[model samples]
Target: MSTLTPGEQAVMSRFDLGWPESDIAADLSISFARTRAIISTFDSNPAHDRHREAQIRRGSQRLLARLRKAGGHR
Candidate 1:
C-alpha cells in the first residue's frame, strides 16, 4: 500500500463520500489547483489505485450484506 499523507487521506475519504473536488478542496483548506494535483498524483500510482479500489469494493460488499440482512433489496 502506498503511504498517504493525512491530508491526502482526508481528500480520499471525502471522495468516498461523493464530494466534488472543489468541495473537498474547500473542506480541506486546499486550493482547487492543489486538489487537482493531488488527484493526478493518486491517478499516477498503480498501487494506490488498486488499494483504493479494493477498499471501495470491500466497503460496498459490507454495505450490501448489511442491507440484505435488514431485508432491503432492489
Candidate 2:
C-alpha cells in the first residue's frame, strides 16, 4: 500500500482498461489464479481508489490541453 510493485501497477492499469483477468494473466506471464489474487488485492486497497482518482484527473487535464490546442475552449 505504501508503494505499488511494478506487477501491481500493471495489473491495476490493465484492470482499469477493462482487460479480462485471463488476458491480464497471460500478458503478465502469471497464473490466472495469481492474477485474480493480485487484482483482488488491488481492488481492496484504498490506494487503488486514489490511483483511479489520480488517473481521472490526469485524463481530464490531458483533455483540457487538447481542447485548448484545438481552440475548442479558451
Model 1 residue runs over 4 Å out of place are: 43-74
Q: Where's the lowest-lDDT run of ten residues in candidate 1?
A: 36-45
Query: Can you write out model 2's per-residue Cα lDDT over 8-72, one digit (the tens) per residue?
Result: 88998998899999999999999999888778666867887787789889999999999999999
For candidate 1, report its TM-score: 0.52
- Candidates in order have lDDT scores of 0.83, 0.87
Best by TM-score: 2
Alpha carbon lDDT at 40, candidate 2: 68
* Candidate 2 deviant stretches above 4 angstroms: 44-74
How much lDDT does candidate 1 score?
0.83
Q: Identify the leading candidate in terms of lDDT.
A: 2
lDDT of 1 by residue, 1-74 (tens): 68999988888778777799999998889999988777756655688788777988999999999999999956
